[model samples]
Target: MKTNPVIETLLSHRSIRKFKDQPLTEEQIQLLVESAQAASTSSFTQSYSIIGVDDPEIKKQLRIISANNQFYVEHNGFFFVFVADQYRNQLIGRDHHEDTSVLDTTQRLIVALGDASFAAQNMAVAAESIGLGICYIGSILNDINKTSELLQLPDHVYPLFGMAVGYPDQDPEKKPRLPHDVVYHRNHYNPQPSRDALDAYDQAVRRYYETRTGGTREETWTGQIARGLGNPYRKALKPFLEKQHLGLR
Candidate 1:
């Protein structure tokens, strides 16, 4: 059956947690970064940067900071740590003799985060198109202080997220998502869809997990969300971000 190019590419995408022990070619890495830069930027400001972790020692250190995710340390042929960077612009402002203290504000930090996320997703799609696998490690937020020091991040540059890329060694079952109505709203905002949509999605997820992972069935989506949200591992992020000089009050 024929499919829309975008839809077909997206349907083929999945998080790959396992990868073969092989490094990517220079040509492949160049194409990945180039495609990442092609993503849209807010107001054409492009307030972001990506640090490619090439050294094994550095990648090992980052793995510890990211809660010891062995997959992050060993699997990927390329590890790109996307950064929310305003220092580059601050330098530009300074060259023009303009004050850049505003770069420390929370609002500007949001802009950098938005830019970094967009670029990261673009690179992910581009890699997937070439039969590469991608996984995002939000766990990098676990130790912001250590990450800041390891990467030698400047005042206005913060690690937003990390991406692991390589050929897939395993094809994990695709996790189910809520129906479109739950996330996509019409002209006017509506919360009703979120209310019951999650319950139905929970069943879809449980069936997937039971057949794929052979894991115990999930009770409900609400319960799963509550379990994750209530964990202390998720709560430590605010203080961590503050320590890195991000989200300045």
Candidate 2:
């Protein structure tokens, strides 16, 4: 298959769990922030803010809050907390004597969330292209309330996920992805998947993990899904969002 450098880089993307103990230079950090800012925003609102945490004390607190139980946070050159922020827009409206409560609606919250997610992905791609590695710490949601408080976030701002970026210490093979046919629909939604197809996919995923872990892990994709979704996850998310003045509509 013919591919360019961008495609190749994306295809090789993997979550780096281990990173070299070296900090990123100021120039590199600036470039990453610039790349994130270059991402597209909803209606030009650009409702996202990034907090780069470098202080050892703050990073330690965040790692504990995340419950990620990983070394990436401690070793990563920079850990970024992406925040979905409508606060700036709300303040702008207030300055004009306009009611800003409308910004508390779920619709606006979604826009800010999308803006933050897009910015994170842009930075991730840029990092991969530059020979750096990244790992997203979604477990930060484990304690969103505490996370926000610790970050000293104001109203109209909510913590999304964090990214740990540094030089890779390990090389992992690319993991398998599901077939495109089931993922990409013609126009509308097509949700049905044949048992045989799913079984094949499950087997493929099992083999991938088994190989990756040197036979230590023999888990399947569907099994992981079952374990992940069977129980409640981050039940506090909704309440946390509401407290942040997001998704309150």
Which numbered prediction scores highest in lDDT against the true structure? 2
The lDDT values for all models are 0.82, 0.89
Which candidate leads the pack in TM-score?
2
What TM-score would candidate 1 get against the native? 0.90
Identify the runs in model 2 with alpha carbons over 4 angstroms from their true place: none
Ten-residue stretch with the least lDDT total in model 2: 66-75
True-vs-predicted CA distance for residue 243, candidate 2, Å: 1.2
Which stretches in model 1 have alpha-carbon errors above 4 Å? 194-196, 216-219, 232-245
Candidates' TM-scores? 0.90, 0.95
